[model samples]
Target: MKVRDFMIKDVLTVNQNAPLSEVLQLFVAKRINGAPVVDADGKLTGMVSDGDILRYINPTRQTVYDMFSYVFVSPPEELAEALAYKVETPAKKIMKKNVQSVSPEQDLEEALGILAKHHFKKLPVVNEKKEVVGVISRGDLLKQIAGRLNELNAKTVSR
Candidate 1:
């Protein structure tokens, strides 16, 4: 099967210039873990995931080294503080650039390979113009495979 056969056509995306707070809201509201980042013209520029947001909001640790064996440590910044500081940051600042993507015409094998090799949960399906046409998640592939397996099992039972 090709990507277009099972890929989700109603893809949710975020603008590159959008703030992290808005991105977070979108993720939560849509119940999605990630989305493709688009430029002003709606072309795919990068990708962002919930993990990326968590990493960005992680607080920095403070440590100081005093003489030979002396050391001082300060409490890490609060999570809320870190979050407040980065909430207004632009999506382009944290989104992963040069993301691997697939075309709608590509075979499922190609999509599977890319997803496994890169440890990606989802991939953006793009058109010739590099516009995001759809998205394929690991769940989509697994669901298709499960259905096919059930069909084969039923055939064997009938025989």
Candidate 2:
């Protein structure tokens, strides 16, 4: 099967300049974990996930040493400051630019290999112009496999 066969056609995307807070709200309202970031021309530029947002909003750690004793902690004020700054930042700042994507004509096994190697939850399906056409998640592939297996089983039983 091809990636186009099982990919989700109704893809959700965000603009590169979109505020991080807006993206986060979209994730919650849409109940989506991630989305591809697009350019003004509607071309895929990067990807953003809830994990990325969390990591960005997380405070940096600091280490202190006093006569051979060391202590590490993240200050509450620093975390609060980061949260404030991050909310106003643009999505492009935190989005993953090195996106792993598949072509619509690519084989399902190849897409699966990329997903497995990268440990990605979803892979964007892009065209030659680098525009996102669809998205394929592991669940989608599993569903297709299960449906195919059931069809084969039914055929075998009848014969």
For model 1, residues 1-159, the per-residue Cα lDDT tens digits are: 888997999999999999999999999999999999999888999999999999999898986757778877777799888887899999999999979999999998999999999999999999999999999999878998899999999999999
Cα misplacement distance, residue 68 of candidate 2 (Å):
19
Per-candidate TM-scores read 0.89, 0.86
Stretches of candidate 1 exceeding 4 Å from the true structure: 65-75
User: Per-residue error at 9 for model 1, in Å?
Assistant: 0.9
Candidate 2 overall lDDT versus native: 0.91
Residues 77-102 of candidate 2 have per-residue lDDT tens digits of 58778787778899999999999999
lDDT over C-alpha atoms for residue 156 of model 2: 100
